[model samples]
Target: MDEQTAGALPVFVFPGSIDVIFTQPHTHKQLVTLYNPYEFPISYRVLCTAPKKYSVIEPRGTLKAKCCVDIVIRHLGANIRSNIGVPDRFRFEVCKYGYTEVSGRKDIAVRLVENASDIARQASLDQSNFHASFPPDGSSRLSPPQYAFPSNPGAPSSQSSPWLAVVAALACIGALMLPTQGDMMPSLLPTYLHLSVPQKLVAAYVLGIVTMLIIRPT
Candidate 1:
């Protein structure tokens, strides 16, 4: 591991650099924020190089632009760890000024660097209202609606249904009546009142009880 770390530093390579190779398994982290101002649209990306010789083996998803977004590098594959090296690279690009295919390739790197500056500045300053609701006088308030909290909550609570409860109760009663092959006279409960798992079982018991009660013995 020591020898591998020593060789990866100072020299830079592309298409899976040393950091890309030796990254830890099942580890990742990321941060994102909105770049859309009232008029201009914005976007960004950040690439972090481990300060020490470590590889970022595999990343699950593409880093995207938006507020409160984060990325995590899940360390995978063989040997990997965070050691002394360059601070992870923060790469960002903005189309707020203007974007062209030619300009995109030519100025992409510069945009990324500037993007970091813009993000840092925004972070340091106090956050203002990104959204609001209008009042009767055409004035606005910064607070969100009260019901929004319940509409999409983090965890769910239990709910009850009366019809489902009835069905479950009947099912339990039927199971308890199983042992006697539905013998009506042997039990105090009437055969007609019993629920059988097999409909035929209950029907036969009811008919036999009725016939015996109605008929005369020889």
Candidate 2:
């Protein structure tokens, strides 16, 4: 166990930044996740630099050991007039249970993203993430008409993912080849190139899954 002095300022791990987006006539919201990696239990409480600009749910709570918690931060009065040009943040204070001393502290920066293209990109990303949680057959796989929340940042990049699937497709073909067992066998090929029955089956299984994913309607 590490004893903490008042000067020691270790902090919990979380996304380094947050963005609150304002696109149209609606209340804007963003979510922040707090992570606790310690073995012992801890308590957390949040303070805002601009409290009137945002709403935080369950602003303080006990966090279990080695766990994660989601903090919903809604932009209060999220129209263009109120949130514009104002820099806001959430201040987090974490301390070990039963102790008054703060074990960790961090300040999270919040930005309001109002650009048109940026909002579209963010809405698309959020939809894709929601779809990913379900099976491939889920209707959410394609972007559906829906209200967008605070945008999540990931969008699948085509440059890397397709090449991986291509390799898997090739492996499926290679899996069909059998090891040279008789006089017809040649010595030129390396022994490692040979596919045993189990190896072949695994490759075939992988190919089947990828094939289905590729063929699925977008």
Candidate 3:
């Protein structure tokens, strides 16, 4: 929705951009107040277009006429603690009741920080941060520090489990032994062959081990 066209609506969103700072594993909820100036009650639907991990608690609800309603945007810190440097953006489309089009929209920009201390340090306090300056000598000055989030070293990487490797090894060994054992025991081969390739391999190795133990009784 265009910001210029939003003024025509009877509803207004205070603090159009919802900014949130997450520093720990917990629930963080930010409130976005919606004011309805019409005399009749208006229903507003909040649509969040962002990662599934981030959610808007009261996404769809009605606002009383000539009153205000708070729309809550929430993020679970647990899901975000290990996701530093990943920015989550949400476009909230607020549509009026019975209207097929969006009446107003707000963009919620979320930045995940490693710690609480970084939140204050990364906040932009001056408008000058957006502009670059040059000296009278025509020499360019250094730009302001860019916002950076620390990576979580302890986060686990995507990898297969150790047990899966063991299972694969067992299956390979069983497959190799099946062909040789089947030749010696032709009658037994049919019974083993009835099973799938994987099943046959596992069964052959198990039976071979059992036969060796039985023959070497002590």
Error of 1 at 214 (Å): 76
lDDT per residue as tens, model 3, 1-218: 44312424534677645344555434355677777887766666553323344445455667777788776666544344565534454443445666656565444445566666655444443112312212322112312111111122122222233344456556655665554433444554545444455666666676566455434533
lDDT of 1: 0.27
Clashing pairs in 3: none
Rank order (by TM-score, best first):
2, 3, 1
Q: For all the candidates, what are their Cα RMSDs to the real structure?
A: 24.3, 15.2, 15.6
Question: Across residues 19-89, which tens digit of lDDT does each residue of candidate 1 receive?
Answer: 22224222222122323222333332223222121122221122233322232222221232332121222
Q: What is the lDDT of candidate 2?
A: 0.59
TM-score of each: 0.21, 0.47, 0.44
Better of 1 and 2 by TM-score: 2
Clashing pairs in 2: none
Off by over 4 Å in 3: 1-7, 24-27, 77-79, 120-218
Q: Which residue segments of model 2 deviate by more than 4 Å?
A: 1-9, 24-27, 116-218
> How many Å off is the CA of 21 in candidate 1?
19
Please provide, for model 2 over 1-218, each residue's C-alpha lDDT reduced to its tens digit, 9 standing for 90 to 100: 22211224465646655655566533265667888878978887776655545556667788898898988777754565555534555566678888877667665655565754564455444443432332332223222111122133232222465667778888787766646334355667777767677777887898898887667664
**Global CA lDDT computed for model 3:** 0.48
